[model samples]
Target: MLIFTNNLSENRNVFIIFLLLFYSCQGEAENKLLEVIKVKELKIKPEVLTIPNPPYVHLIESDSGQYLFYLNPNSKSLQFMNMEDGKVANEIILEYDGPNSMSRRSGIAGLENDKVWTTFRPHAIAYFNYKAEIQFKKDIPSGEVDITYVGSSFQKGLHQYGDKVFGMQPLFMNHHGMNKDDIQKHSLVYSYDMVSDQTKWYDVYYAKDYWDSGKKLSNFSWVRREDKLYIAPWYDHEIQVFDMQKEQVTIKVEAKSDHINSFYYVNEIPGTHEEGLLNILNNDLYGIILYDKYRDCFYRFFYPGFTDDEEYAIDKLWMLRNSRPFTGVMVLDKDLNIIGEHIFDKFQVHASSNVFVGEEGLYLSLNNENSPDYDEDHLRYMVVQFEVGE
Candidate 1:
């Protein structure tokens, strides 16, 4: 009886210590303030490009910083622009059938070796050279493994290292059939080898069963540096680092926010297209991650959730117009330690579609159609340049 009582007392003391440390860490995170060192605005005149529909833009800078490549992915075409002069340099009209045809027009994964690679709708990968010529096309091999949950889209964070490309692969047993076991089995990253024409899967660390219970879908944002691939799941506060050589998750960075809720399983919010929009607005963590080679750090960008008084009811259009207008960015060092967190006011800079970390500074693209400057005749965007400082 005496020994049992002593053991219980020791355990209680340890538990108390753990709680104190956990709360201390959380307090530090809550109090940490992100300071904006500087901000610059650049206006992009859209008339210089030729595309019927609005294009999804990605900024890629050359190593020498002399040229900036603007990869514009449209529904039926992929256009390349030189940001130096805001002019279309080359373009490829994507087709469904032909020698250089794609299964479907998706988005560009990443650019390397002067070639832009895209994830074809359903299950394929295609590469286009600088001259907008299709150079390589191959279907990603799934073998007997089921990949139906991914539907026809690939999540952001397409990365190229040597002869291989890495991106997220969502695994599900159908939305209606998912359970805790299925969610625990979710592996959200995959690699495609250009030479072998094969696809391989990598497992994420700290598998939390939020998706299975909530009937929610999963999305990911990624950043690749050298031999490491950094992955951030849309709904979770953690950022995972996967080592390419080991083919395993080697590090996990958790950046907890006081405004966000801990993992919980609510009944899947269901609607038409509005359902997808609602889920993202309610559940997403920092949705995109960018590596700043110049700053030797990483930036994770995401929308903060709405307040209770805002409105209990919302639709696709309503959410778009009234949802939290501002977005937050969390900066981290190479080790993924949280250096700071900052918010960009919507009035000064509304939601940013894409963020590029450059030697000059951080460039953000405000691509929303609802922007005050958005004009049908011109491709209007307010580009904000941020300089990180002490």
Candidate 2:
């Protein structure tokens, strides 16, 4: 009896310690968030959903609400859906066989007046109309610029800054057997005005910090709200606010997560709303990959822990490269937090490198679970229905 009592007492003490540890960690997570997002009740309709096929879909809105365009890079086709009645308004097939083009590293942009733009590296931006007409093109001049991981020394950190669009170019010198390392030995940031086609340059990082094991800047998204621009730098893991008026850096805040993958500015409607998305890698393969569909969005779902041992079930198969396992989407009320999430079983979403979300549903790419190569499936993109709230 004495031995049993001693064992029980030890177990009780361990339990208490665990409870305290859990609370401490939870409290810290809450504090790290900029603000606790709050959302009202959600109403979801699960029945009204559809799935369309074609592997990848890129969506674009004119901002004037005149049209919603859908670009399918796989088939090299463009389709327009009418927002007013939710119908197929028009579509055009491009001349290029998108999949045959090995260089995804190319640059493509969409304009308001049904105009499309693409760049062919170290050169100029090509303009194409809806009829796939080559309207205007210009070649980029040789100069030092800051480049980004998106492969485009131009498109990676490029954005429209009010009256003009600004692009950054990474420094590359081909003449002297010089590589990215040598470029990093110098400065990193450059800017160009789209309207004027004028260029300006700045060193993003110091020589020491660029090559340092620590203090590397990477994976950033630029969003312009009102007159200012906010950059969510992933490797630095911080949010930087750039004031356009002052033409200087302003606010900087530490992020809540270990890393941030992507972000978008959501100000179409209004009300101090912003959202940030992150692809959090874990010690294990199955980790919580976060996303913010809207500027200020929220989602809620249960995910595997960083150290859980459920490897064989979710990790090995590579079942859904385009579909996420946890849930389809999350709804947040302005502030970013876990208010509610839309989850469906028997569906998997693995890769989100390029995804299109619309009022009708979501379009994503999919591959055969059995065959992991391009020959069998050839990157089958599909559109699935996602209904939020119940």
For this target, which candidate reaches the highest TM-score against the unseen true structure? Answer: 1
lDDT for each residue of candidate 2 in 313-343, tens digit (9 for 90 to 100): 3333233333334333333222233333343
What would you estimate as the lDDT of candidate 1? 0.57
What C-alpha lDDT values do all the predictions have? 0.57, 0.38
What are the RMSD figures for all models against the true structure? 10.8, 15.1
Winner by lDDT: 1
List candidate 1 stretches off by more than 4 Å: 1-31, 49-56, 60-76, 93-96, 143-145, 149-155, 171-173, 194-198, 209-216, 262-266, 269-284, 307-324, 347-352, 367-390
Q: Which regions in candidate 2 have their CA more than 4 angstroms from the true location?
A: 1-68, 82-87, 96-105, 141-158, 168-189, 194-196, 205-218, 243-247, 258-351, 354-390
Model 1 scores worst on lDDT over the 10 consecutive residues at: 1-10
Q: In model 2, what lDDT does residue 265 have?
A: 23
